[model samples]
Target: MTVTDQTAAVTTAPEIDSEQLRAVLEYYFDQDWTDGLPVMPVTESSLAAFLASTDRDPEEILFTIGHLNRSLSVRSAAINAALAGCKPEYFPVVLAAWEAIAKEPHPARGIWQSTTGTAPFLLVNGPVRTELEINSAGNIFGSGFRANATIGRAIRLGCINVFGLHPHKLDQATQGNPSKYTAVIGENEEQSPWPSFAVEHGYAEGDSVATMFVIRSVVHIEARHTMVPEQLALDFVNTITRSGALIHEYTSTLLVLVPEHAELFANAGWSKDDLRTFIFDNATRPRAELAAVGKDALSNRTRWRLPSDHPDSTPDTASTTDEPDTVRLLSHPSSVQIVVAGADNAGVSAVVEIFTLNPPREIPFSSSRIG
Candidate 1:
């Protein structure tokens, strides 16, 4: 039988854990789905098909997140991807993201099911974006694109169903941003004259991969012919750096520079570093501004009272230092991330995708050591 046939046969199984149903129904009286209309049961066969496409073994554990401390095996991930309508090729990117999350020891489980923030937003970089047809263009986060939507949904479902991060249960998002369901994947700069976002994270200019982060929201910097390139970038950074940006001093931001705005910078010969540093340095909201936006912990930087003196240096900086003088976030300008994407028509517009950490800079995209 063909892989598709085998997968379809197994995926059609009629099984939904009655216990889980009982639990969820009792909680959400007016839940999204009605009594009979539930999600497809995640089965094993379809999952195997997804794993088969990846170089990793099916049983390989990618990462564990949230309350259940559920292990993300390649097998389980494949099934999640399948349910989310992901193509077989999208598995590796998904797997890599799980790997990346596992590396982020901030207890993502709480983040996934928190009333405070949304789960980590997944961003695709490299050749995988095109090979899978992810939307990094005009309708980028507006839905309607398959790869643009499903890959992100797969991860979300995995967190919700597999990891048991249901709202109020584990996720505590008070006013969590809307980009949670949206794929904020950035397009490659190679397509234009700019260097790719992943390149800033150390990926070669042409590698294919995925990046995941805990993003709060995204906004745009609209510029016109009246605004020069430098002014335009400054404006883009200025616009996105307001209230939500400083909710926490320890965020890794993912910036999206649309083609129209990118061209202006390209014309003026602005290197990636120049843009990143410019935004990072100028994106500052004063300590008072952060507190006004409900980030009371904003001024906690560098003020950590660490047992008198546990060795002092750059850790004394108010930006990266934490309680007890701990250096939890980046101590310098290298903490921000930037990417160039969007329509080339506008001449000076950009879609900025923001993250809590500087984001997935795992160097040299992982190759299939054993496909």
Candidate 2:
């Protein structure tokens, strides 16, 4: 039989018993080939299943991981997906996510190498969410569900096994967050008052889309008391623009609002655009304060591409040390995106800040369609 990738094709497949499986796990650990978690063994059959799920050929070059100087193929990605315990049906979504991260726009290399311990935050939309049973309700980001756990694990394993981003090797994250384990969520489109996130991003209403954001941290905001849009808006503004907030010249932030909290804005006749505008207008930090925190020094000359503003018009404000002057945290209302997710019972939202090199660095958020 002809094999496409050596990683996926076992020249002489082993018929391993339970004892041999245990030995294989130990062997992978000894080689530091795991993400500190026991990976499901990758088998030839499992690899073939993943490849057959996708329309692409097994030998086709999927994408190249530049940091490790490795060219990833469909077969290799399938092996990593199998290693992460992904169901064969989930392979298409995995391939889409991998393709998104491989682009220069997404800066997968920087996110993997950064000291912020950033992990990719994946948000899936459309029928795929229900089909895959990805958690979009209470404890959506927590452990328990198989789809959420393994899908995220598959991506992490790709970074480890394919991209060679093991800790102390290429991944130099200091005090990395728990999201590095698995951070995947589906948009609660049923509960959302506005159009789904995928719809807003130019995809058809029912299209399956997967968006990847390089997240440095996830700050959960509890707004149980707030009933009005103004109150909730202020809470969001304060949270995203707090002192020591990681707002750089090119920061893109994601606000994942639970349905209950999102209702506050909808009740006030606030469209998604209106909510984004309200947050952008209010989220500001004193320029001197940012400079005091060494942000000004850390700022770069590269202009951040905000969805609302043209790149050329947004002047470089990295050196402005005006103490009394308030510097806007977001360049455009589009910089801070609002996605309705989570359960409706509680008023919990999340502020996911993207990873940046220093200040004034750009990290792209890429989306891919899943069939």
Candidate 3:
């Protein structure tokens, strides 16, 4: 049978009675369909509302899990959205996130089932941030906003129910991350000193876009003492280049600058590109340091010649002078994505390590417009 027909066959279920509705949470839990939390019931009507929010065909296949031999359709995604308590309007963002995941260079790499315990970190941009009230400031990653919470949870639920990536099973994380529960945030565009991240990625300023990244870890940086932008940049560089975290040469980072930190850089005339270049040039460790951390073998095995456009790329003719004693943390300047977020009360920032399976090249992220 075709993918559409297969999805339609399994997605159909008879409505439960009111008596059974009271025990819905337990019912789903017993079926091992929940994320170990109370999920909103996915009624037929609610699912219908979610499907109506998107123009895509309900039976249209979004992507397939190659190993599992399972496909997720638009209708299946809507069911998960409803179960996660997302408003009908929030469905598009969830769909956009899946679109981004589908664009991964090697979907069979099973990023969702990595042992690193990576989470689907979402960056929402454009007017939808305001329209959906996705939190962009003050405890942005913390709980409070429904849009940030449920939209993220919807994706997790789909992974569980659709692809069967349950803990200790398909998912083999040594130690899981808490953000695995939900991690979606919007850019504080109104308070940002630089252009919105989506715009930097070449999207129209008015377009609502969702970009997904697999985050291995989040390192919080607090540099309240520094007024100099370079000083603050160095603090971030220190965190990003930590020897223990430098498992592979292809690793990238998402630098989240709080409004207070962003303004400092703006006042110092440091653009995002300037900061990226600075980090790429300076975020390095002595080769001896990697050996001390027992990462020398892995580092030497993973190192490759960076692209010519990379800031630290060395000429083939003069390769002997390529800093044999040093190891650069970031492969390219473009690998470091900078965005403004969080409250302006403190000089705080966060470095999110992007998870990768050491693909042959920089892993491409997906940016889908929210309609």
lDDT winner = 3
Q: Model 1 segments beyond 4 Å from truth?
A: 1-44, 66-68, 107-109, 182-186, 225-227, 250-252, 284-331, 347-371
Lowest lDDT 10-mer window, candidate 3? 312-321
Query: In model 1, how large is the Cα lDDT of residue 271?
Result: 74
Model 3 reaches what TM-score against the true structure?
Answer: 0.88
- Candidate 2: which stretches are off by over 4 Å? 1-17, 291-324, 356-363
lDDT of 2 by residue, 1-371 (tens): 34566645664566558788899999989877678999887778767888889789888877775655687788888887788888999999888887767653445345567777888878899999999998888888788888888888888887788778788888899888888888889999999999998898899987988888888878899888867888888987888876555535545678899998888888889999998888878877765665565453332244432222333334345335453366666667777777888888888899888753433224347788885
**What is the model-wide C-alpha lDDT for candidate 2?**
0.76
What is the per-residue lDDT of model 1 for residues 110-224, given as tens digits with 9 covering 90 to 100? 6555565655666667776767777777766676777777677777767765666555555667876665554546574545677665665667766765665665556655567
lDDT (0 to 1) per candidate: 0.58, 0.76, 0.82
Q: Write the per-residue lDDT of candidate 3 for residues 131-218, one digit (tens) a residue.
A: 9999999888899999999999998988889998899999888898988888999999999989999999899989999998888888
How far is 249's C-alpha from truth in model 1 (Å)? Answer: 3.9
lDDT of 3: 0.82
Clashes of each: 20, 0, 0
Candidate 2: residue 55 lDDT (0-100)? 84
